[model samples]
Target: MTRIPTLFFATAALFALIGMAWGIQMSASQDHALSPAHGHLNLIGFVAMAVFGGYYALNPLAAASRLAMVHYALTLAAVIVLVPGIVMALRGTGEALAKGGSVLALLSMALFLVAVLRHARGLMR
Candidate 1:
């Protein structure tokens, strides 16, 4: 119920909508070239974020922590950077944005790991 979890869930839903739209467009056009981007949007953006939100919802203490905010911000940044980066790469430009976004996404996941390790025990009871 905390803000972090709410944000994650909302973002996840948004990503799901986008991914679905992308998939529909690809299907309609019969051009599956952007399949990778679409996959990432669904898997990382929707699924991963939904899981993160679920975890934070179950562990309110972690959700309430400052680290949760950092994780949320980094995750959001990763999605923002990654989506455009992938688009650019698909357009034959470069992978800089994708790489940077990947790093940020990994850092966000690492932070999530830290939060789990630090607070998961409290939930065990």
Candidate 2:
């Protein structure tokens, strides 16, 4: 019921819609050129966010922490940067955004890991 989980879940739903629409558009156009971006959108944007949301839902302690907000922001920023970066890369443009986004995504995951570990330790104690 925490805000973190709700935010994540809502964002995940939005990403799912976008990803599905993109998939359908690609299929109709018979253009699989953006397949990589499509896959990332579904996997990272939808699946990963859903999983993160579920985790926070189950672990309210972590979800309530300040770090949770940081994690969410970083993940969101990564997705924002990454999707466009992938599209640009597909068009043979620069990759700076893609690289930066990838790093931000990794950092977000690392923050989640830390939160998990801390929560687990608290539960054990």
Candidate 3:
């Protein structure tokens, strides 16, 4: 129950709530782009963060890596960037923030996976 997934879930939920509010208030708009934003936020932020955090928690060796700190930091940064990036896109900003956030998140996840694999290999030796 570290703060990462918790915060991610909460933030994603908030976005979902906002989207729902928009739907309820603006039924005549005919386009619900916010739902897609909410979907991405929940999928990437909540689900992925939970899975990553759970993996690290269950694998003590993985948690002990030097990359663990980097992983967590990058994850937090990605969430920070991602939420705003999603919202900004909903508000009609360019796609740069979303692209940057997605890249950071993907790279961070890849690094964490490498660390996990290395730790698992070490355990086999």
Candidate 4:
């Protein structure tokens, strides 16, 4: 359980650094335009992953069962779709992968929220 948090924090920090580097490069390149990659890295990689990890750490039981696979799957799904979607979106490709990726990301968040809430309620009793 703690490992989940540790991994999450580490992953988030890595993405944050990458995002900052991308930002610095953009700034130095005379292009103030926003790259979807920046948002994806920050939101999906750093923020979302950290939240999922926190939830898992706080509720170890959630990670002990098959549902753990679901959690990991959803997060991976988000990353899979999100990363490519960001690159495509930034390139002005109006495909539906980005939209679909967003939906998957939302689904992942919902899964995490439900799991955390259920765990919290279990603790209260």
Q: Which has the greatest lDDT? A: 1
* Better by lDDT, candidate 4 or 3: 4
lDDT of 4 by residue, 70-117 (tens): 766777677778777867877798657778888888888888777777
TM-score result, candidate 4: 0.80
- Candidate number with the higher TM-score (3 or 4): 4
Measured against the true structure, the TM-scores of the candidates, in listed sequence, are 0.95, 0.96, 0.69, 0.80
Q: For residues 57-96, could you state the per-residue lDDT of candidate 2 as single tens digits?
A: 9999999999998888988998998888888888989888
Number of the top-ranking candidate, with TM-score as the measure: 2
Q: For candidate 3, what is the total of clashing residue pairs? A: 0
Error of 2 at 54 (Å): 0.5
Give candidate 4's error at residue 107 in angstroms.
1.0
Cα TM-score of candidate 3? 0.69
Better of 2 and 3 by lDDT: 2
Candidate 1 lDDT over 22-85, as tens digits, reads 9999999999988887887888899989999999999899999999998888888988888788
Error of 1 at 110 (Å): 0.7
Between the candidate structures 1 and 2, which one is better when assessed by TM-score?
A: 2
- The digit string of per-residue lDDT tens for model 3 on 50-125 reads 6776776666667766677677778767867876787787788777887888888898789877877788876787
Model 4, residue 68: distance off in Å is 3.0
* Model 1: residues with Cα > 4 Å off, grouped in runs: none
